[model samples]
Target: MYFFLINLSILDIGAISVTVPKSMTNSLMNTRSISYTGCVTQVFFLIFFVGTDFFLLTVMAYDQYVAICQPLHHERVMNRTACVQMAAGSWASGVLNSALHTGNTFAVSFCRGNKVDQFFCEIPQLLKLTCSDSYLSETGVILFSVSLALCCFVFIIVSYIQIISTMLRIPSEQGQHKAFSTCLPHLTVLSLLVCTAWFAYLKPLSSTTSQLDLVVSILCCLQ
Candidate 1:
């Protein structure tokens, strides 16, 4: 799992780097602007890292489930080659997904003013800038991404359910406690990830930005 954790840490850093530095520079310069290319770059890398991290979390769930529920096969199934393949697959998937969203998003004409509602070039906020019909393709992209995410979420849930069942079969209460402690934190993190993202992309759009949007965007970066 350390391998997966390392990948997760890298993704987290990438996610933050994509958005935070531009915001910090703007703050220091007392400017509230980003170039067209800069905004596009932000949208691409932000989506890339975010999508990869979500996939990594799902992989981590499978790792934990194998390690705890089927300890005997864990080493054989999650060998170094397998781990590398999984990590590489996750990164590739992220890049492909990011490319899709970024291309679809920028394909539309931004008839509305260029001012973004949130701190970063979030897809939803970017979509808001487009003319109504111009954004339909981007909206469809978001729906596709959400559906993919839902599949990952369901896989995570199933893994955890099996993990919990295995933990319950432990004879010792102390053993069960130890196992539960290890798994609960991961579950909590997944819960937070799902909740924040669901509220974020699925929430109602507005003509004016909400303070909550700013707060949530900050929280997303901090993740």
Candidate 2:
């Protein structure tokens, strides 16, 4: 649990740092410009950390599943070696996904003005600036991301179902309460994270930016 928590903390820091620092500096300096290279780097790390957060949340769900549903085997199932491997795998996957997105996005010709409406260089906003049909490649990336997120969402749902079923069979009110107390907050947080991400990225793109876009962008930045 500690290992997973530490990794999650690191992921959160990386994710927030990617955009917040530059956004803050821009605000303080009263400027709203980032170099093309810097924008690309931000896009890459932002995707990386967001992907890592998704995987880490899934992992933590699995950890809670084991702890609540199969308490006797919790230590063995979530051992140090397993924790390290999961953390490494999450980071590795994040990097790969981010690389694919960054490469595809930057390959397009940016004929449109580079003024991103959002405070940061979000992929959707960047896509808006592309002048070529090659932007379809980035659309493919979004589709792939949605598919992956759906799979993880399904996994977490199944794990929670099993967890709930196990808790119900515990026979003691206090025991059930204890079990739920541990899992409910995790479930709530995961739901908020996944739903916000899906809504932000999977929704139909508008030709003109709407108020909803800004709201969704702000929601995505929230902790």
Candidate 3:
């Protein structure tokens, strides 16, 4: 689990660093502009890191399930090779997903002006600038991404159900309390991340306003 935790920490750092430094520079310099290349790079890395973070979180949920519910088999199931494979798989999938979204997002013609409403080159905010068909294509890609996240969410939920059930069977009050303490916070964050991301990305843009986009985008990125 420490291995997975390490990867998560790196992803969190990378995700925030991708935008925060440029943001701080802009704030200090009193300028709001980023070169086109810089914006593209930001979108790519942000997608890559954040996408891997989500996958890593899902894998960690499974790690916990195995640790708590199948302790006897934990070593065998999550041996060093298996752990490495899982981590690598998460990163590989993140790269593929990021590449798909990044390519599709920039492929659209941007004529609505380059003023991104949000802090970074967020896919949704970038979509707002498209005069071409980014909405149609990017929506498809975002839905695909969202669907994958939901699948991970479902897998985590099922794993936790097994975890909680196994915890309930622990016979000792202290054990059950300990288990609940561990599970509740993870579940809470998972719920918030999934809900906000789905709402922010999938909701109809026409019905939404820039202010709402700004707020939701902040929630999506910060979490």
> lDDT: which candidate is best?
1
C-alpha lDDT values of all predictions: 0.88, 0.86, 0.84
> Weakest 10 consecutive residues, lDDT, candidate 3?
204-213
Give the candidate order by descending TM-score: 1, 2, 3
My TM-score estimates for the predictions, one after another, are: 0.97, 0.95, 0.91
Q: State the lDDT of candidate 1 residue by residue for 1-223, as single tens digits.
A: 8898899889989988998888899899999999999989999998899899899889989999998899999999999999999999999999999999999999999988988877778888888888878988888888899899999999999999999999989999998998888778678767777878887878888778778878877877677
Instruction: Report clash pairs, candidate 1.
Output: none
Q: What's each prediction's clash count?
A: 0, 0, 0
Model 1 weakest lDDT span, ten residues long: 184-193
Model 1 off-target regions past 4 Å?
none
| Overall local distance difference test of candidate 1 | 0.88
Which is the winner by TM-score between candidate 2 and candidate 3? 2
